[model samples]
Target: MIEVKHLHKTFRIPAPHLSRWERIKAAVTGDGAEKTAVRDISFTVGPGEFVGYIGPNGAGKSTTIKMLTGILHPTSGEVRIDGMSPHKDRRRVVSRLGVVFGQRSQLWWDLPVRDSFDILCAMYRIDRQRQQRTLAELDGLLGLGEFADTPVRKLSLGQRMRADLAAALLHEPDILFLDEPTIGLDVIAKRNIRGLLSKVNRELGKTVLLTTHDMDDIEQLCDRVMVINHGSLAYDGTIGELRERIGLPTILRVSFEAAVSLDNATEPELGFTVAEANGCELTVHFNRQELPALEVLRRLERYGTAQDVHMEEPDFEEIIHKVY
Candidate 1:
């Protein structure tokens, strides 16, 4: 479990120097300028919960994660992981946590994949039997056997991601933090990662906190989601709740068997906004809050027997856009 309250983090950045005079002026100005990356943000993740933390670029999502993982210190407020302070007891806290940054690798680039695992075993001081069991389980779940002897630098993006994921779990951490775990991965590779994460959460009972820009990742993997915008908590709840908050409308596209025009008639009382219509094809937007989808269908029958109907909800990108 993780709890963060009124957490704040700020970074002092040097101002750009326009001339030698400006450089000298900044040295005396003391740090030039400061940017508050995260400001008074607060949230909690329950044990065994899979939560997605999402935001646009520069939204402070990474800053918050770094603070939680003890990679960066917070300026103020409290962060507790399973009742332990990560800042004060970083080693003990990290032992109970797993972290994977998509843009960074934990594996040794020049070493064989298996050797990297071995080094991790030594670092964590895991016993031989436990290490073997963990590696075997990871190999089965992540399919790392195919390139176990290959050097990390020689592996593909997908393979490297799987290897990184395996390395993160070698210690059997209670909580996992994944930052863009599926970035730059092909469809199959992304599927593999998602399947592995689902298994880890369901069978292994690991609590997970995932930060990603991909809506598919969040839709497929997260049960609960937290949206951050402008360095603040914009939304937090179930995925369905988020959809409703954004007023995301479901689209129903209908192609009629024959062309017909009811343009002069009173608009059908479907509790939906008409998005588009062309002779036989009509697109309607129905707010789930105002009407259940099935009811919308019954109302559409009055126009004509629909040749086909396609229903779609908003994707993660659209939802984030609405939040921002």
Candidate 2:
């Protein structure tokens, strides 16, 4: 489990060079040119929970992760992993945690994948029998056997990623911090990694905090989502709740028994605006808050015999844009 309370991180950026008059002007105006990467954000994650931390570039997602993992100390506020401060109790806390950054590799570049696992075993002081069992489980779940003997430098992107994931769990850490673990991966590769993450959370009971730009990764893997913008928490809730909060227009495509005129397709009673219309079909967009879906269907029935009706909700990416 993880807990963060009123966390804040600020960086003092160098001010741009200015002329004598400009410098004097800036000094008089009281401009310090400071950047706040995280602004008093607070959240908690329980054991066996998978939470997605997402935001745009420079939105403080990585900064917050670094503070949580003890890589960077916060300017103020508190962070505790299982009631132990990460900075104060780093060794113990890290022993119970795993981290995988997609852009970086923890494996020794000159060594074989198997050798990296063995080194981790010794580093963590994992018993030989338990290490082997963990490796076997990882091989089964992540398919690391195919290239287990290959050097870290020789494996492809997907292979290297899977090997890194296996390495992170060799000691069976309690929490996993994943920063864009699926970046630059293809569709099939992404699916494999996501399936492995889901198994780790559900079957192994590991708490995971994932940060990524890919919406599909969040949709497929996370039960709860937290959004950050301008160094502040913008939204924190279930994906369904996020969708409702954004209030994206719902789209409905209706087919009729007879050709309907596009000119007469506007229906204020149903609270739907015509998006498109063809020979025997009309595509309309409406706010679900304005009219109930069932009522929209009832009104469509009056237009014609109603051959068919199909509705589509907004995609996760669209909802994220709405957040900003």
Candidate 3:
């Protein structure tokens, strides 16, 4: 439902003003240097696909989203939503999209949440029956009824976020653009937002392009991920594919019946590194692709009688750090 080709956005930084003479010289000579926010990035998101666009704070994730949504023009590229250019036909293209920026709100501050919804329905020309149905569904999924009648200014951050999400979806757009949608919420609130997003993506079949620093959100919701760094596409694939590409290590913790001497421990031809060791307990790090878990266990058996064993995948934060 979304396509971007050779996308690039450059912003000119303003020069510091010194004197009137210098200002005139700058006006004629163009003193500002250009910085590229997005650099020749290209990707396509299919219908009903949930994709995560991730990067560090200054990595151009939001800049790309803005270009895709027609909020900002690209320096030289093409962006299309459902085969129509968002730049050339913004109104038509945007009608099929719902966007939510975590730091901003579409709802009026002094009005009740329901009032905002009513106004949005009118603006979108949605019929009363459709608006009610949409709100009823939102209430069930988001638990918005708790603050539906409350003024937006009075609602808690979590409540207000939920309302904003509801507002985004009221028109039942074909696609959802979510940028840092779970930014400052508490654990429970973040979980709620993630759950709602998952439902909106999977069950409702909305094509979603989410830009977030929250790796948990990507791990939980996205079927595929696109990583951006230094204004360029760094990675694009499934989480598992990314882990293998980056050689993200899997950890195995083994507890022995008795204290084992490191000198006596038999190392296999394909050996693993000791991440941590204390008395009878040892933590081993190995790439599962290179040395299988079974082989690691077998190697451990020769060292000492095993008491217990546990294994874990690399955390999402570690994976993102590798991307950076």
- Candidate with the greatest lDDT versus the true structure: 2
lDDT of 3 by residue, 1-324 (tens): 898999999986556665777766766776767888999999999999999999998999988988888989999989989999988998888789999999999999999999999999998999999889998988888899888899999998889889999999999999999999999999999998898999988888899999988889999999999999999999999999998998888999999999867774445563788778899999989999998999999987766899999999999889889779
Candidate lDDT values, in order:
0.90, 0.90, 0.90
Tens digits of per-residue lDDT for model 1, 1-324 = 899999998876667755778767666775568888888988999999999999999999999999999889999989999999999999999999999999999999999999999999999999999999999998888899999999999999999999999999999999999999999999998998899999989999999999998899899999999988878898999989888888878888888887756663346654777777788887888787789888987877777898888888877688778888
Pairs that collide, model 2: 96-174
Summarize candidate 2's per-residue lDDT along 164-194 as a digit string, tens digits.
8988899999999999999999999999889
Colliding pairs, model 3: none
Total backbone clashes of candidate 3, pairs 3 or more residues apart or in separate chains:
0
Whose TM-score is higher: candidate 2's or candidate 3's? Answer: 3
Ranking by TM-score: 3, 1, 2
Where is model 2 poorest over a 10-residue stretch in terms of lDDT? Answer: 261-270
TM-scores, all models, native as reference: 0.93, 0.92, 0.95
Q: How far does residue 20 in candidate 3 sit from its true spot (Å)?
A: 9.0
Error of 1 at 218 (Å): 0.4
> Model 2: how far is 16 from its true place, Å?
5.0
Error of 1 at 166 (Å): 0.6
